[model samples]
Target: MNKYIEIIKNAYTGYWNYLKHELISINHWDNYFYGLLCISLIVWLLEICFPWRKNQSIFRNDFWLDTFYMFFNFFLLNLIVLIALSNTAAQFLNDILSFIGISISSFQLFDVDDLPKVLGLFIFFVVGDFIQWNTHRLLHRIPWLWNFHKVHHSVKEMGFAAHLRYHWMEPVIYKSLLYIPMAIIGGFDAQDVAIVHFFNIAIGHLNHANLGWNYGPLKYIFNNPKMHIWHHAKNLPEHSKYGINYGLTLSLWDYLFNTAHIPYNGRDIELGFEGDENFPKDFIHQELYPLSKK
Candidate 1:
């Protein structure tokens, strides 16, 4: 086992060394600004092409809410990761899986590398979303878990902010489990992970976008924005399509699980909770209200 591990570790290191020495150089600042611009442009195109809803518009009241959500979501995640990496002890704790037979080194686990970057990004999104779909389906099937899961369903609207509207605990459960396991298993390097995560951000936005792109077969395979909008529907039958396009890149799981919903009308039926029309928007209220005595 140790020999196998060492081999894997060496291969991983060798790949990085080769990349650093032979791969094309990247200007981090220029790349970051350009990356953001490209993402924004793609999002805009997606909105124009495959709008999840028929009348979706970027200028709606929810625009500001989603913008704020994007800001805070990035801020919170960066702050948490920074804090986790600040101290040597904290950093080790953040990467405890290595000590337990897993071998992704700290630096290698989080840096965004190129080449494998695109594939890794989409794969991570799919894996994470698969976890989410199963958990969500389980939540609906078992009333106990519904208490926590319903917080997401409670959102009465579908927009970029809807992506951020999830209860904080939701992320703690889903993201921690998925991320920790991936880190320990060790596939892509840190750079690969970052690039993939950036890809995920675009997918997340596209999933909740108010766009109109419907690339027929592509819609069937990939979870287009419209498909996700339907997932946000409040109707019982519509909500039952919970598993379709659970991941950002693929909908195969939804098909496998028999939760894939094919829209005959090419539009999302409706939005919000089944019976609860007065879901609150305040962060504290969203966090605390779901658990309070009903």
Candidate 2:
């Protein structure tokens, strides 16, 4: 009982300190709070200047709702709950492993420490993206996961901020699956991969933005607005009952695995799923909608 209490206390303190550092520290320019703000502002400016749907309003439908989701999922919820919970979970997992005499540190596929810095970072980035891509597919294929993922697909109009409009359970799922694989390929610090993280965040914003960019030849390598819009299209391909274009950062997986689908320019495609007209429009209801018996 004392051990559990200590873990909970330490988790809250550690996350609070980390949050404070992220908010005020200037020593690290790679802070996520500022990074998210900068990227959001840049992409939003692009959308305003060059919106693919010319008739779409600057304040598109559900715009503020999605904005709230962005900050809520990114910072507010993390500060209040997720950060502490994740920390506690990590400590508990470590304790369980210790009890079984299993040292996770002893089981690396390869240590990034011995490799060249860029190569190590590249390996970590690719593997992490691949994991997310597969997890994304599961979110569509599995019924229960899709219920949680519905918050993201409920977007009636896509925009840059829509990138982060997901159920809070998503991070729990993504990070839980990510932990073991990342642990096995250890020695790289979070700071070491900040560049990749920021780049992915930018791509994610672009993918959800009201832009029509397909990246031309790079469409095969990277995900872009054109390819990703179809991911949110109201009408899924008859063949793709689960979903299509499951790529999170890279399009390579979708192309290689044959899930890629873009029959034509998707600029005017209607967004959301079949029953989306009935989906919750407010933040509070959207969060709880997934967990409801309905």
Candidate 3:
């Protein structure tokens, strides 16, 4: 009865939530998925509304690629939650705190503290990406990890969908290793974690977009597309410019790490690794051939 009531309340609350220009209603449970769908559609529409000269090919690829990633990440995220991590990213946080001699819980950090829950979640999203940027850069630089990272870079185009071309093995590292450490330390609740996921998806989409929009000073600190495109460039010298724009919300780490690249010419350069020229084109080949035996 309570579950049914909650659903009714959430459904009615969405209109007010939409009017406020907020992504989700604070009081609604299912608003997260609905909000994500709305935002994803908006992103696709924006790609059509504001076309890019050099990335028309990218626009074409995005239709199928984005669809593929949407479903792909959906399945993988659920799998990790159900099977791999057992829905206890918070527990992993506690374990990491124990190792570090800190006594913190994700719930306690978000709930029992004077800090606002929204702010706490924002920090979690930012900090986790900081770690992700360095770890992702390492994956590209290190030979063994590069084997997996290369799969993502193998795409010969740039679009919103290109972001989802990551190797299948990445989620194991992203969820279990990259995210769990922060979850254990932060002690955020389910809502806080959900907001971080939202931020990740939104920022990730922006990073791979072809639109030349800039967030003014925010561009200096965030992983906007301008800097991210260079990360996917075909040139090895350019590709090594990897760790820049490490921050999803703010590029502080990129500046600190000296990996941030901001282009002045306003051009969309060619993307992907040279090795992918001979690579397969079909979805199956794109998804599997990279990891397969030759």
| Candidates arranged by TM-score, highest first | 2, 3, 1
Superior candidate under TM-score, 1 versus 2: 2
> Is 1 or 3 the stronger prediction by lDDT?
3
Q: Candidate 2: which pairs clash? A: none
User: Which stretches of model 2 miss by more than 4 angstroms?
Assistant: none
* Candidate 2: count of backbone clashes, pairs at least 3 residues apart or interchain: 0
lDDT of 3 by residue, 1-294 (tens): 454445445544543454353343456753555656766777666766775545375347535765676656654444333233433444555667889887654334333234676676666766677777667766766666666766677665566666666766666566565554563455567667676677777777776666666677877667676677767766635554443444545566777867766655334566677676776666566567646743
Candidate 2 structure quality by residue, lDDT tens digits, 1-294: 687778678777877788788888766778988889899999999999999998989889889988888888888787776776776777788888999998778777899989999899899999999999999999999899999999999998899989999999999999888888888999878787788889999999999998989899999999999999999999998999899999999999999999999999999999999998899888889989987944
Instruction: Point out the worst 10-residue segment of candidate 1 by lDDT.
Output: 81-90
TM-score of candidate 3 relative to the true fold? 0.73
lDDT for 35 (candidate 3):
56
Q: Top model by lDDT, which number?
A: 2
Task: Single out the weakest 10-residue window by summed lDDT for candidate 3.
Answer: 78-87
Against the correct fold, how does model 1 do in TM-score? 0.66
lDDT for 160 in candidate 1 is 54
The lDDT of each candidate is 0.56, 0.90, 0.61
Kindly indicate the candidate among 1 and 2 with the higher lDDT: 2
